[model samples]
Target: MPQFAELRRRVIQGGEAHFITSLTRCVRWAQRGGKSNAYFAKTRDDRFIIKSLNKAEKASFLRFAPAYFEHMVKMLSGQRTCLAKLLGVFTVTFKPTAGGGLSAATGSSSGPNEGLDLLVMENSFYGRP
Candidate 1:
């Protein structure tokens, strides 16, 4: 967890991801495609992906987050890697508005993503053809 802010700055700057929004977004991913069953959402700007994570998945990441950060420092320090360039490792929640169900989230009546845990990462396919 040391130098986290600096590391984040470097990663974002290196990736030229300054256009990424800083708001607390309740996203609705446009193109949701993955092999897993977890709910996925994309940032409004289409620069990032939000993936719902179960307790197991969350625990798994936390267990390795430190080492991952170390690797990230090395990568940013010049030992480039093919691994994911994580912008953040945090939780997400979709609190319902007073209007009721988040039908706008999926164009349906289901509230599957409500009250779930999530993590945000830079979209690897961003700006790709």
Candidate 2:
């Protein structure tokens, strides 16, 4: 995840703190005509966009992730590519608490407690005038 950390540090203002803070406050982002039932949310800080992906989409991305990192290293022209700067992909799940309650905190996105598969990318409109 060093490459991912590099991407985060390069594009964001701070480290993990900034990222967590950004996600702490987000608003539902409107759909711009996609055929999937994915959910979209824009960080209130306006630095990133979170898209919930289906199982199939998530699997597809994971399959080509190694190649993606390779290709990203070649993005040196400072121009936006067709694919936005994808920061990371992960799942956020809820875990059962000590009291047998589901915690709002994120956990493993797999297993019996299925969670959302998310794609976090740099906000295309970030830093816009």
Candidate 3:
């Protein structure tokens, strides 16, 4: 996956309202009326906190979350007035870790295969009425 520094730089340059990491596997209860999964991550300065969503409940989100995030970012930056806005989407790619003794040297893909979709948003935390 991209280093944390790289991701941070992208987020800042993108000028998104918020950077989110999906905590789909962490929290118990759903926020936003179970509309999306949950997530927790630090801000630009590394102050950490928690947020929740219901993303896993929908297949579309799983497939196209990245595209959706990017769309939102463009819309928001344009200063368009809409009921809802999106910021941007970022895909974090990571190198597979090595496992086993010889296999590790062989560069096998047996280690952790993990990735995440970063969904940027503007005014999403303001809550909806």
Candidate 4:
């Protein structure tokens, strides 16, 4: 969470909107990829995709977040590119409920193996008809 706090600061300072995730409202409805070991889900509004990240992937993300953030800033602000913009990175603990919804995590006290690491990206085709 501290890392996210810092990331949020950097994102906003770089002229991008900061996205705060609500795991309670998101639904992980699909799994994708094989060797990549990635699962894909969308926000309830279908505006973003949440991708699961393994430990190594998460580490790589954090290591390059500064450069990635800058790349996103440029790509989103009129630069032409086929790359999807990363909206946020988060670690969340999801305890399943009877209705199949996730219980809210209270704080950042969860251990590394106890939570899900995720990358949030804008859905490039979200507005397509």
Predicted model with the maximum lDDT: 2
Model 4 per-residue lDDT tens digits across residues 4-88: 4544455433333424433335777555455785887877766667899999999988898777666756755667778776767
Q: TM-score: which is higher, 3 or 4?
A: 4
lDDT (Cα, tens digit) per residue for candidate 3, span 1-129: 133334344544432233434322222222355434456442333322333334452345557656654564564467454533333344444545454323122334645544455543333344345
lDDT of 1 by residue, 2-69 (tens): 44456657656433345244324547654446666888777665666777788888889889888888
Cα deviation at 105, candidate 2, in Å, is 5.6
Runs with alpha carbons beyond 4 Å of true place in candidate 4? 1-24, 31-33, 94-104, 107-113
Sort by lDDT, top down from the best: 2, 4, 1, 3
TM-score of each: 0.64, 0.78, 0.33, 0.63
Per model, how many backbone clashes are there?
Answer: 1, 0, 18, 0
Q: Quote the lDDT for 40 in model 3.
A: 43
By TM-score rank, best first, the candidates go: 2, 1, 4, 3
lDDT of each: 0.64, 0.79, 0.41, 0.66
Model 3 misplacement above 4 A? 1-32, 40-82, 99-113, 124-129
RMSD (Cα, Å) for all candidates, in order, is 6.6, 3.7, 8.9, 5.7
Model 2 stretches astray by more than 4 angstroms = 76-82, 95-102, 105-111
RMSD after Cα superposition, model 2: 3.7
Alpha-carbon lDDT of model 2? 0.79
What is the clash tally of candidate 2?
Answer: 0
Screening candidate 2 with a backbone cut-off below 3 angstroms (N, C-alpha, C), the clashing residue pairs are: none
lDDT by residue for model 2 (1-129), tens:
677877777766787689878888989998788878689999998998999989889889888888887777667446445778888887787765667767655544433564678888888878899
